[model samples]
Target chain A: MGITGLFLISFLMVHCFLNSLIFINDGGETFNLGAEFMAKNWVIRAMEIVLFGGLLWHIIQAAVLTRENKKARPVAYAASNPSANSKWYSRSMGLLGTILLIFLIIHLRHFWVVSRFTDEITSGKETLFNEMKEVFSQLWVVILYCLAMVSLGYHLLHGFKSAFQTLGWNHVKYNSMIEKIGVIISIVLPVLFAAMPIAIYMGLIK
Target chain B: MSGNMNLTLKVWRQKNKNAEGKLVNYQVKDISPDMSFLEMIDVLNEQLIVKGDEPIAFDHDCREGICGMCSLYINGRPHGPKDRITTCQLHMRSFEDGQTITIEPWRAASFPIVKDLVVDRSAFDRIIASGGYVSVNTGNAQDANSLPIGKEDADLSFAAAACIGCGACVAACKNASAMLFVSAKVSQLALLPQGQPERYLRVHNMVAKMDEEGFGNCTNTGACEAECPKGISLSNIARLNRDFFVAGIASDN
Candidate 1:
């Protein structure tokens, strides 16, 4: 679960970096070229396959683990409060992940699957960049993406450092530093990724 | 530092795990805020013993908060109202006069009740026995610099190792999961050079044992962090998932 989640985070960084080019004022041509390259590239397609597989594996594993956890404690205590021991995000990973998964489905349906199999939306569009902008033009789509990215950020905050610890990279001196890094990666990447679509739709960047 | 106060204590008293338990109310007067919560409890127990009562029995040792032996659910919070301090170190000053405090044991199936407020946390020991240590047998001690570990890795390992193995994570968990504890132990050793040899086997075995012990899976509530005396991070559980996944794949290969 950690490996898959971390891999997804790495993908987010790259995706965000690529998307950031949209803001470079090259008249959408550069963004269109990048999109076209990604669309045609075998390596990118292979990576997407891995990313999808990782997402599926991470979700499935979390579901199974959650089911097992419920079975482990069949009875609820009369007075039970969990805030005394753990972080809110640590305990809510499954819920947040589920939300993110729903967002992923919506995302793929509109962008990925739409771009690949359907020609209805792209009939009059000259470039993939135009289709991308059209998709983001809808306020609802942008809002949904923003919400999902926020959830993703929350999941990553807990997940980033967790992946390191599981691989046994925990050391007292470096643990705090690694945790801070995790926070930055989780928070910064997702926000940056979400910003591009909003910025493009809002005309902050042409 | 010395101020007298009146307080109402509602403590759970049970003869054994099988025996029924309920909150028994007792009024404590003249409590000094300077006294630790446990010391106040000691005063109450002394009064009970003098009155020929059995007195409240709770598990406590090394009141310094490192042993993870002191477990309490005070007024709906684990280890009392203090943040990042164990129940032993919690002082009375945190509470106001005429306040009502509730005390209970660490509630979990794995930790069966040996007596009032004292559950047999031997299940934790069993989990550790399953694979919490390194199999490397370096006779005596090796030089610290022998293994040129990065400062970052070393620091992370130490942080993971800070887990005191208290069942607070389990109790604080809505699902009663022990992932934080198990992961911290697994990650602390797994990250170190000495722990590499048995990393796969260790995680696989320990996680399997944790499952067998009836500990819940992590639901990611972050309550454990709020209640933890050591403030062990939930990221450790995430690390556990990664290691387990790797181990699962490796074993399959």
Candidate 2:
């Protein structure tokens, strides 16, 4: 689970960096070229497949673990003062993860499915570049993307370190440093992704 | 009359785990401001017994902050409003005259009430039982200088070791994750050279025990740190993760 989780985090960093290209003066052509490059590359395609697989595995494992945890305690107390002993986000990962999953579906529908099926502006298979710009042009779509990115940020903040801790890489000497890294990665990547849509919606890069 | 004050106390009363509990109010006259919180509770219990009412049940040992056995949810705060002190150490002077103090036990799913205000925290014991100790052979005590541990590592281990197995982390957690408690125990031993032999199994067994105890996973909200009487750091949770990761990989291999 830790390996898969860390790999997913790395994927997010790369994906966010790629999306942030919208903040630069891409003039439509840069995005189109990048999109074409991804479409044509076998390695990227293989990675995309692996990314999807990892997402499925992670979600399934989380669900199983949550179920097991719930079953371990058959009786629920009338009052729970969990905040007395644990972190809030660690307790709420399932909720945040469910929301993130919903956001993921919406994300794929807006970009992945749309690019593959629609040809309102360009021919079908025109490239993800045009689809991204079209989606960002809509104010509501941009808003939803930003919201999802924020949720992702919160999820990652708890999850990044949690994955590490679960794998037992936590040494006191490097523990604080790892936690700081988790914070930076969770915040920076999502903000970078969110910035792309915000920049485009405001016509900052156009 | 200056030091003496009458106070109203609303204390949680439940006959047993199966019995429903309510906050029953009692008026205590002539409470000294200098009396410790537990002493005040003792005074109230004495009054209750004399009146033929069942005394309120609560947990306390050593009456010091070090034991971590005193678990009380006082007026919307764990261990009362005082920061960095256990319920046993909180003085009655923290409250004003005529103030109504509400007291309840640490409520969480993993901690079931054995009686009123005293939940069976043996769940913590089980997690510790899983892997809280080093596998050192019983013999002559090793020389302190035998292990060449760096000062920095030793200091960090001691800080993590300072955690007294208080369920305060579970009580403070919204999800009741025992990551902080378990991590502190795991990291303290894992950082030392003497603890090397059992390091891998320690984290794995302890985390497994933590899960078995039905404690929730760590969510990284840092509430445990804030509420910790010993101020155990959240970094211990991270250390636990690293150890678990390596253990998982090693086991897989």
Index of the highest-lDDT prediction:
1
Candidate 1 Cα outliers beyond 4 Å, as residue runs:
A25-27, A72-86, A121-126, A171-177, B13-26, B34-36, B42-57, B61-69, B83-89, B114-116, B128-166, B172-207, B217-253
* Per-residue accuracy of model 2 over A1-206 as CA lDDT, tens digit each: 56778989988877776666666675766766666677668999899999999999989988876775565444444344456544666667788889889988988888777654576434644556556666789998888878888778878888888776666576657778988998999889888888877877787776
Model 2 C-alpha RMSD vs. true structure (Å) is 3.8
Q: Which lDDT tens digits does candidate 1 get at residues A144-202?
A: 89999889888888888767765556556788898899988887888887887788789
Error of 2 at B20 (Å): 2.7
TM-score of each: 0.74, 0.83
Error of 1 at B24 (Å): 5.1
List model 1 lDDT by residue over B1-253, tens digit each: 3478899998888998689888789999999988899999999999999999999998789999899888887877778777888889999999999998888877777878777788788888999999999876755546656768988779889998898887887877777878888988998997888898888888899999998998876545567766777877766776777788789887642
Task: Give lDDT for model 1.
Answer: 0.81
After TM-score superposition, the amount by which residue B97's alpha carbon in candidate 1 deviates from its true location, in angstroms, is 0.8
Candidate 1 DockQ vs. native = 0.29
| lDDT of model 2 at position B16 | 88
